[model samples]
Target: MSTTIPGPVLQEADWHRLLLLRATRPDVVARAYAERRRPGRLLSERGTMFLLAADHPARGALTVGGDALAMSDRRSLLARIVAALEHPDVDGVLGTPDVVEELLLLGALDGKVVIGSMNRGGLDGATWTMDDRFTAYDAAQLAACRLDGGKMLLRMDDRDPATATTIESCAQAVSELAQQGLMAMVEPLPYQRREDGSLVLCKNTRDLARAVTVASGLGTTSAYTWLKLPACDEPEVVFGATTLPCVVLGGVPGPDPEQDLRSWGRSLTHPAVRGLVVGRALLYPADGDVKASVDAAARVLRAVQPSARV
Candidate 1:
C-alpha cells in the first residue's frame, strides 16, 4: 500500500505535461492526431466501372450526326450520353467535365462512375504541339463535384521538353489522386516528330513498352491507376506491354462498323484488356443511330468478362 502511493502523482504529472505541450504546439499536435484517423472511404460495390469513350472533342473530331464538333453541341451530346447511361450494361462514362457536368445537371450521374478528362489543350492540329495543358477538369475539381476519378493523356515527344513537362505534371497528378483514393487513368504514347513538324504516335511493340514503363514508374501507389491504351497496330504487341488493366481507345471511326466492332471485341478478349473506350465509332456512327451503336459497343464490353453479363 505504501509503495503504490506514488502512482496517482505520476499519472497527474504526465497529464499536466501533455496538456502543457499540446497548448504550446496546438496545430502540430492536432494534425498528428487527425492524421492517425483514416483519410477517407472507398466506393462500394454499387460502383461499377465502365469503358468511357468520349475522346472526340479532345481531338476536335466531334462529328456526331454529320455535325462537325457535334459533341460541342451540348444538348445533343447530353441526350446521347443519357441514353447510354440508361443502358443496363453501362457502368460509367469517361468524358471531359463539360459533358460530365451536363450529365450531373440533368440528374443522370447518380450512382454512376463519372471520370473527368483532365487534358485537351494540345489540340489535334496545334502549331506549338506537345504542350498539352491541363485544360479540362482536375482532381480537386472532380472531388468537389463528388466525381469518381480523373484521366489524362500523355503523348511523349522526347524532342519536345513541353511534352516532358506534361508527363511530369501527370506524374504528380497521379500521386495526388492516389492520396485521395481515386482512380487516374494515364494514357501514355511514345510519339515521333515528323519532317513536317507533326507529331505521330507510335504503336510499335518497343514504343508501347517504353510508354508502359514510364507510366508504371509514376506515382506513390498504383492501386487506383489504370491504363487507357490504344488498340495497337498489332493487338499482341499492346497485350505484351503491361499486365496493368487496360481499356482500349476508339480512334476515328472507320468506314466499316462491323469490322471495327469485331476488332474491338477481339481486343476485349485479351487477358489484360478490360474494355473499349470508343467515342466516334459508337457515338458518331455513319448510321446516326446512337442507341444502336452504343448497344453494340456494350455487347462487346460485356463479352470481355462473361461474369459481367447484364
Candidate 2:
C-alpha cells in the first residue's frame, strides 16, 4: 500500500498561521504534544516500517548532492514532509524538536510513530564536530512530549577524543530510554577526519562492523536499543556484529533510482534489518515527484518482504 500526495493542501496563509500560533501561544503546542493520539505500535502487522527522516538539517548538514541548501527552506521542507507522511506506506517521521513540534501542532503526526532526534550539537564542518552533545530532546523530555522514542547519532572516530564524550552521552541516553520503556534508535557511523578538517563517514564493512559492536554494548541494557545503520558492502557481515533490530538509513539518492532500490532490496533480505528510515531519496527524488518516489520505495519494500504483515 502507498499514499498519494495532495496538491497544495496547505498554502502560504496556513504557514503564517502556524508561525503565528507558535509566536502567540506556545502553550498550545505543549498541549498538542500532551494530548495528540499516538500509534499503538511502531510497526503495524508488517513488523517493518518506512520512516521519513528529517533530522539531517538539525546537524547543519542540509546539502543534497550539488545543492548547497536544499533543506534550508523551512516552509518548503515541511510541505514535502507532510506530503510524504500522507503516503500509506510511509509510517512516520524522525526529526528535531522544532520540526517535530510543528508537525505536532499541524496534526500531521496522529497515529504515526514519531521519533524525536536527541542530539544536534555536532554542527557540520565545525572543528569540534565529533563532540555530538545532547542539545535537543532527552529521554524525560520525549516521555513528557509523548513521543515513541529518541534517535541519536554516535560517530566513532578512533583518532578524535571527542568520540569519548559522544559515546558516554549515548550510553546514558540508551539507559534512560530503556527505563522509560522507549526505543533508543542509535546511528553508529565510522568516522574519519579528512585533511581539510571535514568529518566523513567511512563506508568500509569492517569499520561499520566495529561501530555496530560498540553501539550494541552501550547503556545498561540492550533490550530497547535499535541500530539505524547504513547499507554497506557485505551487509550481512556488517549487521552480523549485533543482534539488535536494524533499519537501513537512506543517504542521497543516486542518479539511478532502480539501482538504489535494488540495493535497498538486497539489504532488507538480511534477517536483522527491519525497515527503511529514508530522507532525501524519497522526499526529494530527481524527478521531483514525491508521491512517485515514495510509491517506488514502497514497492521495493513490499517486493523484498512480501510476507510482512503490512
Candidate 3:
C-alpha cells in the first residue's frame, strides 16, 4: 500500500499572499488560529497519530540526507507538507510557529492535531548544542493559539553543564502544558562528543534506555506527557524504559529505504509506542517522493499494533 504524492507545486503568487499578510496584516495570525478548525480528538479511532514533522529548520539543522540546504527553501517545504496533509491517514503536524502559522493561513491545517515545537535554540553543530533553550512557542503561546500540544527536545550529555539547565526548562514546560490539559512531547536523546569534538547521538541501547527513563521522570507531573523516540535495534532495550506513550521519530534517511522502513516497523509494534512523528525520511526522500515515504510509514503503524496508547 503506497500513496502517490505529487511533486511540490505551490505558485509564487499564492506564496506572495502569505508574504504580504506577514508584512501588512501580521495580526491576522491571531484570527487564523481563532478561526481554524480543530480535531475533535487527539487520537484516531484506531488509537494512533500519524503526524508530519516540520520543526527541523527552526533549529538550524536543515540538511536532508546529502542536501544540506534542502529545507532552506520554505516554498518547497510548504508545498510538500500541504500535499502530504492531503492524505487522510495523516493525523496532523508538529512544527514551529512560523511553519504552523503558514499552514493555518493557507488553510492547510483544518481538523488536524497541531503540536508546537517548544525549544530550538540548540543549533546544529553549535558548541552549546546541549543547552537546548526554549526559543519558540511557550506553553502560554500554545494555549493562546489553541494548539493541541507542545514538543521539546532534551539531549543529555554528562560532560556538558548546559544539559542540567535544559532539563529544568523542559520539566517546567511539561508541568505547565499538562496543567492546561494539553499534551507535552519530549524527545530525549543521549549525546556524546567525538574525539574531534563533534557531537554525536549515543546509539548505545543502555544509554538510550537511560535517557528515556530520565525524561520519563521529568517535570512536576507526567500526566499529559508523550515521548518522541528513535526506533533502534532491540526496540525493547530503549522503549521498555518507560510506560509513557511514545511515537517513533524519523530522523535522517539511510541509503536503503527498506531498512529504515523495517526499523520503523519494529518500533511501531512496541507496546509503548503510540504512533509516528516522521520528517525527512518522508518529506525529502532520496527519491523526492514525500507521499510514498509517508504512506509507507502510515501503513506500518496500521499493520503493527493499533491498540490504545492513551
Top of the candidates by TM-score:
3
Every model's TM-score = 0.77, 0.94, 0.95
Full-model lDDT for every candidate:
0.67, 0.86, 0.88
Q: What is the lDDT of candidate 1?
A: 0.67
**Superior by lDDT: candidate 2 or candidate 3:** 3
lDDT of 3 by residue, 258-291 (tens): 8988998888878888888988778877666777
TM-score, candidate number 3:
0.95
* TM-score: model 2 vs. ground truth: 0.94
The number of residue pairs in model 3 that clash at the backbone is: 0
Model 1: CA > 4 A from native:
1-49, 55-67, 305-310
- For candidate 2, write residues 67-154 as lDDT tens digits: 7777776776788889889989888999999999888877899889999999899998887888999998999999998999999999
- Locate the minimum summed-lDDT window of 10 residues in model 1: 1-10
Please give the range of 10 consecutive residues that has the lowest summed lDDT in model 2: 1-10
lDDT of 1 by residue, 9-70 (tens): 21344435544654675454323322222213222232223555665576565554345555
